[model samples]
Target: MWNVPSLEEKEPELVREVEWFRLYTWTHFSPSDTCRTYGSGVVQPFNGSAFYVRSNCAFILTHFTHNRVEYDITIRRGDNGLLSEVEIIINKVRTVLQNGSILVEKKSVSLPYDHTYQHVFRYGIYTRFKSSLLPLTVTWHDVPGGIDTLWVELEKEQNSDITGLCGKFNAEAEPKCPGDLVYQDKGPAYVPSCSNPNPRFIDQENTSSCVCPDGKVLNDRADGFHCVTVSSCSCVFNGRTYLTGETRSTRCQSCLCKDGRWHCSENSCPPRCLIEGEFVTTFDGKQFAVPENVLVFWQSSMYVQVQTSFGMKIQVQVFPEIQLYITPPRNHSGVISGLCGNNNDDTTDDFTTSSGIIESSAKLFALSWSLGACSENIPNPCINTDNALKCPKNQEFSYNLLACNHTCRSLSGPDPRCNLQDAPVEGCGCPEGTHLNQENNCTPRSECECHHHGGATPPGPVVIDGQQW
Candidate 1:
């Protein structure tokens, strides 16, 4: 007889673990073309918001009219970035074709990298590998007018180190000094030159040296005499106090307060430097409000982060992948030097998959607004069994009564031993076809057959109903 479990007795668990050998998972450690099941292609944990993907360590910095690039890459297997005998598959999405291996010099093979945070490898991408060296050493080109598509994949010399990352000439890159580094000689921490897009400020004193209090490039005001401030306007000089005023600009722009405490031009709510709601007050006591638009995401982790935009910004991250049977993607195709994983404001591929599963790219963006946004409670799933037509069907219940006087278990929560068991109604015995047996079960049996005495007589099934008789 089959080993049938009795409903009244303990029922065995119905779920079984499944084998998922074919699913894929992405991580900080990139994967090989052939899926050898280890480390990201990157050697270190990158800092910027973007990087370039390439097949080799070389970067193409010059002009290229050609549409594609070809490189020979050899994969190195092992912690030391050594070459291995195994080969990997490279899937091409442009033409939907599988291409040949990226050879190292002239040979074809796979390489192994620890892909640890400290050893990430990256470079500028080349559709075709025949481009000349960069016009200027260390420069980026594939970037959109504003897009930062630098998350690239490339190979580097054996045992490469990322602590000493090199940056190329971003001709468009904001001149470091003319912008954020502009230390003002006035009470205001003026918006970066990148914001107001102002010209450089050089002091008119000391023979073509030092910056003028105002935002103007000045030549020699050279003399043995000391440079004097208007003595009414205030500006921060060398982290010290100084007064600035229009003494230079008809005192329109002068150092009214010389001790870096006040600005004479426009005093409409100064911008104070703040750290996490903490105010950094100077000894002289000038009040300023910290702009609330600033935000830091993924700070001091893979990359220290900062926001350079205005208006509303949001920061969110999706983790703990929910899909039980599928793996998320990590083989980022586009990377550039000094940038990785979607930091720029323009077009980016920051994880947009159809599956409900979550991945690293599942980040909550930073939305900046003058007035902060508020949060509300999330609604719970409806469980009104008495309401909808299908609600009763959705209501599922099953229980097991173990032997002995032990109570029955409930499925609701961690608390077990529910007491909802009610015995069958009194005198509502077993149905017609079944009868109580030695095992306390309602056992079913075959009907008794009758044969005629004569050998020629026919046998028939006994029936209690009039129609069957």
Candidate 2:
């Protein structure tokens, strides 16, 4: 009997585990970047993370939505490799910034975790938000025994990736086209009745051993799939296997074959993009290419679904009118849209699909706005600051000039929606008799002068010094 050494008797050698650790998440697109159009959305629905894996550096981005505003977080790996920052500016006035402690590799901590937006009934979360892309930078201890610190200056977007703003991620794709691709087969699979798996497939090889064997054939059980037409009208299949019953339908039965178009059958063919114009919307700023059969709806604001080759429905809306301010204000929450798109074929609504650039290096932009909100208080038209009853300026309508007295500079801005800034126009000057007080506009003296108006006295030429004497 051959004696085999027991498992424990084997030479003891230590195997090292591959170096792996976790890093804290960092969140903030850039320190500071200018933005025009203002729009905001929740970054994370639940708890999850995104990582930027570089040569020797890896950082994790964690996010969660509270109330409606989103909170961002960052984490890095290595000894004392942890760095985190989150900043928020509301109404361009009150600001809140939080920084975390320096951490080591494989270390973790859940801070008193509260930007503390009063998400309660008395102080519910603010529904409005804004964001813009700015240059980004990161610092870490990736030096000696550490990794190389990484700094990235995100390129300014010539045109932001607006497509992602309008795009819905394609989680997975499913079947969308006909399964049976028109593939011609040979041998028994091609034979008329014999259903031969292998035969005299070559057209003129008159060999008796290969011809479609008459009577019982060794090819009776031929297997495979194919598409064939006899008399171009009645079609049949002996080896084709479908989840449902066999198909003998004519070529014209599926979809209209207008203008000699071929009948393509693949269950998962993707549709093309329908973006034709410089279509910009509140959605992502990524560029999108127009595709065939894709209906880009300028008339309607809705999602233009991209049926991928895997049957996964990825939605890319077309809002050619986003800049036009037709429906809900650009910064407001609203749906912008595009029509269905098909391939390059002349077919319009045939509903067939073609492949698209599902992945690309496209830039993304976020629109934003700032301050200036107006008060809704309508001042009494009849009363003056002196508590005196004043005669209406526009008598026919009893309209008070003071009622329209709006100060443009008084508008709280830097954020458009804040105090609701004054409208884009020059304001009114002094009233008639008052002739502009110290402010140089209108100031009512003892008797209100109607000079500017018809009743007001006109200014007579005055003698300078003693010239009149």
Candidate 3:
């Protein structure tokens, strides 16, 4: 038979079992906190049973285990008598945080080690248990004076089972210092960071400076400052950080940010004009309100005839269907502008108004060139409604074969009345290179009958101007 311990007797045992390890020599929450003098020595341990010191050299700082996971912390002192590096080993994995900068080595792989238990934070790393058990946090302050300090916090159930430089867990044991006291001013004021890597130091100053490890610079974001490599740096535009190789498009240019700079292309969008039924888009890309009496620029009655100053004639026909024929001159390649656009081969500025200003609205631009006010809105004639004009059954629909159709009548020579520049038109006439002969049939110019005074005459020649054959 065994005697059961009462709650009163077991309380101390349970309290001793749940031990908290807050490891740090300096108790200040921040490096900039007020300074105070304590027992002399390069290294110090708080709430620990014993403290030890060694000459400028590397040595194991502490060794502990929690939940079967082993943690080893080591420190190296430089020849200048300051902490040079602090290495932490969790089980088989190792990470070295060097002094002067907060640079940590790539973590080593360790099998059978549950990586989810560890978490990396801005200032340090922490490990958590699956249950609501307290976490073990290790913080490394990389400042000049604080670099020598290693911070660790853990909760244990068995305090008596622990032993190391951290000291015995029982409160009765006094902390013993093994080295002679040497109270000195905190080391240099600051550490180097990416933004200000080479910080200027003041002699005998107690201020702390921020720093980052080698090959890294400080990157500012909305949240806070982060250290990043040079190649990984991002570009900031309009207060926004843009990753490298990102692109942005504007109205006239396409820009990409590369190497912390913006590379842009020349004007990419050409001016355009659109004049649809109820919508009009100007050359400047602005849409204008449409009027009820929107004039039809491309279509006209077949009876309408146009005579251009540049020796071009456009004749329309209403028979089989509304058709307009164009007869262009061999000369005059450019120097023309209107609804047909400037024939200069460039279509960019086709909407130049009469005032010489390129207009963005087709309605306004066309109004500038209008000879008179447009008539009342007319119903579309093409819409097949009752009372609409119908084509004769015997007559076939006529389509404009070419803008410049050569007829047999023109075979004799150019018509003086139609000696106009080239323009598109449509009319009821024979196909190109054919003439209306005596039989009223379309015949090739080579097989066409002769004409006398605008009258079709048979191949048998007739007298003309006192010349007979």
Candidate 4:
């Protein structure tokens, strides 16, 4: 019976004693050919993602392709550390011809098992244009079931490792029969018709049986009838026991022991500089409301991270010394490098301004903005404030300085135009036709005309007489 576990069941925790194996595939094809495996390790028999599998190591020189490729490989074990049998199933969307020949299918041939019960099979595809030479390197491992965690890899095969392993058996053997015929009184041979894919003796011969070669023994457990040598099966690292596919976690990295080597990856660590809440005090001792999603973190050695809502982020790293390194947000792809400096009107000792501008020493360029500023007040460049606007009496214009989409510096002073030099220039504007272009300059009721020949231009005073327009 074919044994497959139910998918609804929760996977059990992996033990430390069971051995595991890793199976990786490499493929390459394109203007630049490369080899990469679709998945890794001996667990998880299904791969929903599509990827190519190369024959031999020549990635760029192949023309075959397979679709809907999936693998179902299982290894069964018996008593006394013996591998009872190995079963493999590779089902994919394949095309067949009218003559009834399989094309674009995985062709595999099983081989003898070693002392550790490791079975190696050479597998590839059969297509109309080409049939891959027998013996593609596919390994089947014996591991405890119900544990799932795997990673894929990209690699290339060099030095013809695939062809080098062709025709090699798991154990060495020799024929026990001598060259000379021992008995010649044999019955007459008869031909037999064959119609099934089954093994049969070519001709009956009276001869001695074969035995294990030198320095080898007939391993009774391995397939019950195979020759193999002995080797160590235990592996230990850092005072902890590790099996073939089991993984371990350190402070900054995670590692998995495969075969005998360890593969590790760095973990994502926390940042050095951190800011929380919706309000941040600037270097000038001003408190302003920021967005809720603004987060700043330290990245790499010299760079700081400013991540905003959505997928937007600004990387801030120090320049050689005097300036800052601020890469444009990835979400806003076309934005160019910007300035980072203090607000000229801000009298803060720290170079970082209230508006998130980092003033440079030479005032040549602004490097980066703060996370708070990037989210709430980017492009506007000025710190937003809440203040009541006071126009002269008789002017009687209802205006709130805070409603101007910008900022107001001082609430108790005239010309409170929010003139932070490094910030974007923004000021108060009066109602239509009543000019309030400058601070405290609210002019009204003015008309001018200009004319060169037959046409008169309104809104200014310019004429063929060449007066100021």
Number of the top-ranking candidate, with TM-score as the measure: 3
Local accuracy by lDDT, each model: 0.24, 0.25, 0.45, 0.30
Worst 10 residues of 1 by lDDT: 14-23
Query: What root-mean-square deviation over C-alphas does model 1 reach?
Result: 36.0
Instruction: Decide which is better by lDDT, 2 or 4.
Output: 4
Evaluate residue 380 in candidate 4 and report its C-alpha lDDT on the 0 to 100 scale.
45
For 1-469, candidate 4 gives per-residue lDDT tens digits of 2322221221332111221211222122221122112212212211211121111111111112123333332333333233333233334322221122222233332332221212333223211111122212232222343111112111332222211111111222321211111111221111110111122467644222233344333332222223343221123565556655788774446787654346778555432222212234443224454665664432222334455655454655342232243433445534233233222334442455445454554221222333333333225434344444443432333322221211111111232122211212122334444432212233453432222234335454444455564
Better of 1 and 2 by lDDT: 2
- Give the C-alpha miss distance for residue 92 in model 4, angstroms: 36
Model 3 clash tally, residue pairs: 30
Off by over 4 Å in 4: 1-126, 129-232, 236-303, 306-469
- TM-scores of the candidates in the order shown: 0.15, 0.13, 0.25, 0.15
Over 331-420, each residue of candidate 2 has an lDDT whose tens digit, in order, gives 433332222222333444323222222212111100111123534443444523342232223211112223122222112112111222
**Better by lDDT, candidate 3 or 1:** 3
Task: Indicate the worst ten consecutive residues by lDDT in candidate 4.
Answer: 188-197
By lDDT rank, best first, the candidates go 3, 4, 2, 1
lDDT of 1 by residue, 1-469 (tens): 1121112331222111110011112344343211111221222112221111112222121111112332111222332222122222112211110132334324433422121111111243512221121111111122222111112233322122212111222223322121112222232212212112233456521111112345432211211112233333234443544333322222123334432244356433333222111122332333333344543322100121233224222222211111111111234344321112243344444332333222443222211111356343333535343522211111211122121111011111221112212221111122444422211233344222222222111125434433453
- Candidate 3 lDDT, 1-469, residue by residue in tens: 1122222443443422221111234545322211111211233333422222323445555565666767666666555445566666676556666534332246443322334435444532322112122234565444454354455555344333433334233435432211121112232233333334456855535321233345555453323335566556566666677787898875567778765567789777676454322335577556554543332122211344445545565656554555566655449675676666666656678888887888877777777777888854444558333533333222222444332323344455544333323344443445445554322356766686654453455556677767895
